[model samples]
Target: MNSVLINGITMTYDDTGGGSDSAGSVLLLVHGHPFDRTMWRPQQGAAPGHRVVTPDLRGYGGTQVVPGLTPLSTFAADLAGLLDHLGVRRAVLCGLSMGGQIVLEFHRLFPDRVAGLVLADTFAQGETEQGRKERNDRADRLLRDGMSGYAHEVLDSMVSPATVADRPEVAAHVLGMMLAAPPEGAAAALRGRAERPDYTATLPTVAVPTLVVVGSDDVFTPVADAVFLHDRIPGSRLAVIEGAGHLPNLERPAAFNDALAGLLATVRESARDGADMTES
Candidate 1:
């Protein structure tokens, strides 16, 4: 566990020291909304040959939450600052759900710093008017009733029925993460998320290699969303983890890690090819 001051907020992150003997090839893992860096524990030590970093986004985990709506751009900038502070010039950015939107914003703002992208269980569309209203309503409810009730309410939707019945431990873990989240921070994020721009126009412009992953049973962001991304992002690969839900990385770590490992290999190969072209 490490902390850095980014944009005047203390951001908490974990870095598994440069996992490879190579250079400028870190894997930055960004967690989803209402969840902290702990969600990435299943992936820790999984990327043996590449440095893997998991950071708690502002207002989650040990990080300090800023008052008011913190836009996705702010989250992107904070990540850029964290990379700068770590002396990393470029990295493969992997994000899930809201984290995926933040990655898109990061690519929009600092494309040069991104080597590749892994978007899991997330979509490129912004919230519709009804979606915005629903999020606001949920935010208000969270502020009023608190995390305990809200966590339980969303658990079924977040994970599959199989997970809830067969994997009680995983369900408990997810609930715990949600319950521990700061209500104000969650509310602020919901509001900020409601305003996120649609990435439909931006996806076609993504020049880097991308991997679109989804759980077969993901109710929030279904496999259809993954297909949408795979079709839009040039040369992107799509991997669907069967019998899993939104948080496939946690529910089925082995399958998710395998997909990630494949993406990392593609990224490395692409980098090598570019370097060869440069020398030629």
Candidate 2:
């Protein structure tokens, strides 16, 4: 893990260390709530000849844990700061769930810095009153009971029943991530997430090549949400991984990687077209 001073904290990340500034050159993977950079380990080498950077958000993994609310905007800003620190001018951002929302926020705030976008198992709409209450209540419960019970309860939902039955190792990895997450960090994230703004308007404005992916069985943010995103984002591609759940990248890494590979190919083609036009 590479540590850097970004946005006043010692942010930690994994960087593959070398790649050019060409299309699909830099891939930044953002992990979702209650998980850290290691969640992206399977994807680090998926994109050959690219720099794959995975970072732990403010309160997760090896990063400094600030025991208070940390907004999505703050997370986005930390990513931008990290890019600056690494001398990267632009990157293709890939995120899942809460991480996807943070990627949207990053695009909203720093559109010029985004070369492409990959949003998986996430929705664009803001929270409803009931949803907000549930998240806050969950936050309180986590602070009170810690993560063990919550991790146990959510395990089946995070992955699918089939995954737990057949892929015990993947299930264990998911559970381990949840159990290892700092309660304070997870609580603050829940509180902040409860206040998230709708990215409904942000989708249509995406000018870069985008890919919207979801597990067909995702209960948190279903395949319908991915279709909704695909419908809104002009020229975006939608991929539904069959038989997987919220975390398809983990439940079905091969399919997810194939979808991502397709997106990277599209991005490269677009870049080449642009360069040819400039050269002409």
Candidate 3:
């Protein structure tokens, strides 16, 4: 992993070496909450010929943890800074769960920087008052009891009973990520996320090719949410990985990678067509 100073924090990231003019487009993977960039290990080789860069958010993984409210906007800004540092003018942004929301926020703030979007297991609506309270309450509990109990409690729902029973290693990796997350970082993210804006309006405005993916058995943000995104984002594709839960990329890496590959092909083709027109 490489390190760079972004927004007063030493942000850490892994960049699979590739040139700017490479045939593959730059793919940026943003991790979900209570998880780090390592969650993307399965996808490191998925985008063949592309530069896949995975970064730990400000507080998670090896990145510097600032124990305070870190809004999705802040996370988005950190990404923009990282891209600028890497000399990347634009990228195909792929994110899951909370990471998905961060990608949307990044598009909202820096639309020109996004070449395409891959939103997985995430929603666009704002939190209800009750939901906000629950998130803050959960943050408090995490601060009090730490992440072990919380991670254990939600393990099944995060993945699925089938995954836990069948794919023990995948289950272990998910649990390990949750348990290893810095409680302060996770809590602060929760607090800030509770105040997140409604991105429902943002969906129809998406100009680039987009893909909305969800686990068939996801409880947090189910197939319905993915459909809503796909329906609204003009021409966006939707894929539901069967027998998987919230973290489909981990539970069904092959299927998840297939969906990403399809989207990447679309992006690459579009880029080539645009370049041809410009040259003509």
Tens digit per residue, CA lDDT, model 3, 25-66: 899999998999999999998887789999999889999988
Regions of candidate 1 where Cα sits further than 4 Å from its true position = 20-24
lDDT of each prediction vs. the true structure?
A: 0.90, 0.92, 0.92
Candidate 2 segments whose C-alpha is farther than 4 A from its true place: none
TM-score versus the correct structure, for each prediction: 0.97, 0.98, 0.98
lDDT of 2 at 180: 94
Candidate 2 lDDT by residue in tens digits, 1-280 = 7899998899999988466866668899999989999989889989987888899999999999988788899999999999999888889999999999999999999999998999999999999999999999998998899999999999898998878888999999999999999999999999999999999988889999999999988998988899989999999999999989999999999999999999887888888888899999
For model 3, the superposed segments whose C-alpha errors exceed 4 Å read 17-24
Residue 233 Cα positional deviation in candidate 2, in Å, after optimal superposition: 0.3
Give candidate 1's error at residue 214 in angstroms.
0.4
How far residue 93's Cα lies from its native spot in candidate 1, in Å, is 0.6
lDDT of 1 by residue, 136-211 (tens): 8988988898899989888998888988898999999999999999988888889899899988998999988899
Note each model's CA RMSD in angstroms. 1.3, 1.0, 1.2
